[model samples]
Target chain A: MKVELTLFGQLADIAGRTKFQLQDIPDTDTLQKKIHEMYPEMANMSYSIAVNKKTIHENTVFEGDANVALLPPFSGG
Target chain B: MSERKIKNIFSQGPIPATFIAESIQKHSSQTAIGGHSIFLGQVRADETEQGKVKAIDYTAFEEMALEKMHQIREEIFAKYPITCMHVHHSLGQVQAGEICLFVFSSSAHRKAAIDSCNEIVERIKAELPIWGKEIMENDSHQWKVNK
Candidate 1:
């Protein structure tokens, strides 16, 4: 299955892109690992993962096509 | 009536001072509200090693932020005896010294209006998934971190 993965804040700058599709990524942990492999600089940065607009704490298996987002520290007023 | 409605608070760019005045005037008919509290956030120019910041480009995960804001609004209303509340934030580019966020709260007494307005501003900063990129005069950019 393919999932649309979006990166926000500094994560997007690090990734060099914002939203794209991921194929065959099983869970959040795998997704993070793949991103780190592609952009090693992202490995040291702090971020949060959200699936379908809800933030997730632990690795969550994808049951179907999902919308995933990588969020860096928010700075809003 | 209490609200569960999701309010769209994002404005295109800088929030004009006239819009804020009009908002206050709209509430004049609701004379039951004895006190009104207002908060405005302005973009400040900061000098960085690269250059001086001239403006800010603000963006947000809009679909999620509105949902989060709805929850915050509900909680604020439940905790404070506020009769009315309104919040507005800016998207796109806002120049330095321009107003970017506006929050207003009204109540029968001064305390609830003041307290709730403060709380709402705090929550918006802490909880919303918005980001600001400081655009420098040298054409470089830096991400903003809330202090």
Candidate 2:
């Protein structure tokens, strides 16, 4: 399965874009695992995952209709 | 309950103190409160760990920030005996020594007002989808948060 990932804040700068796609991830957990595998530098970064703007933790069953975003800690007032 | 008035978010330059003062004036009443407390978060140019912070570039996921602000207002109202509350935060680039956020709360006593002000500011800092870039004099920058 393929999933779209949206990055924000410092992560967006690191990734060099606001949005991208990941293909062939079997599940949410694998998607996360694969992301770390591809970008080992992100291993130490704290970030949150949102499926369609709602934060989710653990394994989320992606149905291909949801938009996933990786959000770093917000520092603005 | 009185009507909700004034803006909770701004995308321009420095936040005017009059906005906060006006909000307090509109809601102040001898019957409703005897004390009011406010917390104003000023942007500082000095970055303790990363050297001098020249300025801060503030940005927000506006849709989410507003939703979170409304939720915070509701929570604060429910948690305290406050008669009124106002929260305004700056958006876009703000230089050091400028106001970033202004929170005001009025209650029957001083303690609750102070406590409410602190809580609201804390929650806003922790949960809101706003980001700040700490720009140094050398042009190097980092996200403005203690990790």
Model 2 residue runs over 4 Å out of place are A23-26, B1-10, B28-31, B48-50
Q: Candidate 2's chain A scores what TM-score?
A: 0.85
Fnat of the models, one by one?
0.82, 0.57
Residue range A33-68, candidate 1, lDDT tens digits: 988998899999988888999999999999899999
- Which model scores highest in lDDT? 1
The digit string of per-residue lDDT tens for model 1 on B87-138 reads 9999999999999999999999999999999999999999899999999998
Question: Which regions of candidate 1 fall more than 4 Å away from where they truly are?
Answer: B1-3
Estimate TM-scores for all models.
0.96, 0.84
Per-residue lDDT of model 2, residues B44-98, tens digit only = 8775565788778877767767767777887788899987777788887777888
Chain B, model 2, TM-score against the native? 0.83
TM-score of chain B taken alone, every candidate: 0.96, 0.83
Give the number of the best model, judged by DockQ: 1
Relative to the true structure, candidate 1 reaches a TM of 0.96
